[model samples]
Target: MTFDLIIALATACVAFVLSKRSVAHFPLWRAVVTPLASIIGSGFLLLGPILNIGYGGYAPLIMIALCFVAFLFGGVIRFNMAAGEQAIQNGDYGALAIRIETLSSWALAFAYIISVSYYLNLLGAFALSLTPFNSDLDAKLLTTGVFFIIVFVGWSRGFKSLEKMEYVSVSLKLAIIAGLLIGLMAHFGHRALDDALIFNPPKLDGWSALTLAFGLLITVQGFETSRYLGSEYDAQTRIKSMRLAQWLSTAIYLVYILLISYVFRPDQMSSSETGIINMMQIVAPILPFLLVAAALASQFSAAVADTSGSGGLFAQLSRNRITERQAYLLLAVIGVALTWSANIYAIVNYASRGFAIYYGLQAALGAVIAARQNTGWQRVGFYGLLATLGAVIALFGQPVE
Candidate 1:
């Protein structure tokens, strides 16, 4: 009870600070919040158990590798924000660059469709997890309902009202997350003093491990949200905000994984989607409640953000031939189909591949623009390699078994 009180107080304090006028009104913080919210969204809830179960003691190392790869891809997006935007505005870009950027935008739209399904499905799972009706079919039905709700609200009243929920949801999620970290740290320290920490060996080796890591890219995939905010923010602000968001999320993820990796034996971890909830039950009685709240807020906010983004991209790409309402309807239809057709793990893999293809195209576009500007071959070559890596992830990333 004392620990729970401490956790609750910490969470409340963080929430209060984040809600302050000074912090909320800061321009860079506002810019940082959008991408930061997306980057840490549903992924934070899922990664702990998945990483520990899959990689065992090596989970923290794998987390670092994922963050590093995401950082590199973020660099590619940042480069395009500065160079690609200017070139397109001045007609300084070539036909191929234009085509690649267009294709990448399409890829991103499709990825958003899959990701919305992913987010809502997780939301449904978590929503039901603490109840008596926590079954797979029940979860999917709930997800389908939420999809309809989002589409209805979006088509009827517009997302203007719903969009206002982003700030509150993000603040709540971050506060709960800070509390989670505190609980995990205290648990970890207790085990350390007792010499109870376990360092289990990796469960899968070499090729299988590599493919699994690739499949998990969607966990770190949301930083590119900054690249597409060109309409709202200037290039420099978007670039800097993206870098800051990535850095903040990376730090959060690494610490969470490190504290979590050695705290439990491999045999105790659950492989189910809501495994983190059960794992946190062992950390603190209050943690499961806090985690579920964070999961719901983060997932709904992320789904709404991506749905809004996908609809706008569809309308923009169609040159306004397709209205945003029509796009929302289409996204709802596709998202419902995805919710019924495959499990969450399969959706995660599909989303990862979709984003990888988009990243690959963006990297290729970056390389082309660099070459056109007579930039050194070394920079172009690095972008080419990054493009190839993205392609590899798209082609080879596999679903968790």
Candidate 2:
């Protein structure tokens, strides 16, 4: 594990340097890689168990279909970004876009706070679970304290330093997850073959699958972050990046689901908040500790990234009504409060709804863009109805676990 950590850090450092250089020199790299990195994280732990337990052997199929749905949503966001950029270019910064932006920013902030809170709870739980502190309250308190400290550091120093840490955290996270998949392949190769042939599992109702997907919506939401990068990149680049991000993330997630589904018994997996740890423990005792470390790194990186995003959006939407630092701190405080009020699963549900609402706004923006570009009336109606349906699902969908 120690050697693996060193290797992951070294790889991340190199990758970070290359990525920064690419951002400076190559627009394509800037477009492809930046969005790609931002789109994946520890949210998979929550997503995977829920998906597998709900859909059994059919989780991969559901995930594939969901990924395509996410891709369509990504297109909506991309079109919206293009429209916004065009609006700025035409010197028409329209009222509708501004209203949507303001509302989306608030929703995005709410979602990020909830996400941070849930991750803090997860990290605290993983840490304590390794020891004797068995109370959920104790974990929440410890997580709150840790979260506050992270917020203070981020607010004081800003994301410049945090961005540097992201390379390491992201690399460690991907490497650990990949390692787990590889480890599973090695340990259960013959068993996996037999399991594939058997493929016996409980029936998965369509409504249950849809509800589970809605509940886990936040896991696939990182592609939308590219919409916020409009100020940094041109609309074309941002749109392309969003498209690339959705593709890359879809492939990665599909591979992970395939490996884990074949490797682990569906009945053995449960809807535990520490589902990753539970999955890893069944494979090897040491695997949980490594996954815990990876989870901590991923969650910290995610919190810092979202903090920076929410702060920037708040500042932009407010037209400098509040300073970025103040916005960040306020978000952190909200996160801390939320951590005390809900456990990880409840937070997941909140974050799913939060992001779902934000996506609906983006879809509305897509409709506006379609009208402006004089695109087909079909696209206009498609995005319009998608926005309505997304909002409805988010508002009323039941969570199975």
Which candidate gets the maximum lDDT versus the true structure? 1
**Tens digits of per-residue lDDT for model 2, 1-401:** 66345544554554465546544366755445445554665556666777777777787887887777778888887766766655733546456766776677688867777776766777777667666785788888788887777767777787566666665566566666666655555556766556543343645586765776777776777777666666667777778878877887787788877766655666567677776677867766667776777677667666666766777877876788977788778887888878877768778778778878888887886776676678999999999987996797688656555
Worst 10 residues of 1 by lDDT: 84-93
lDDT of each: 0.89, 0.70
lDDT per residue, candidate 1, 135-217, as tens digits?
Answer: 99999999999999989988987756556677788899999999999999999999999999999788888999999999999
TM-score, one value per model: 0.98, 0.87
Any residue pairs clashing in model 2, and if so which?
none
TM-score of 2: 0.87
Q: Which candidate is the best by TM-score?
A: 1
Q: Candidate 1 — which residues are off by over 4 angstroms? A: 84-86
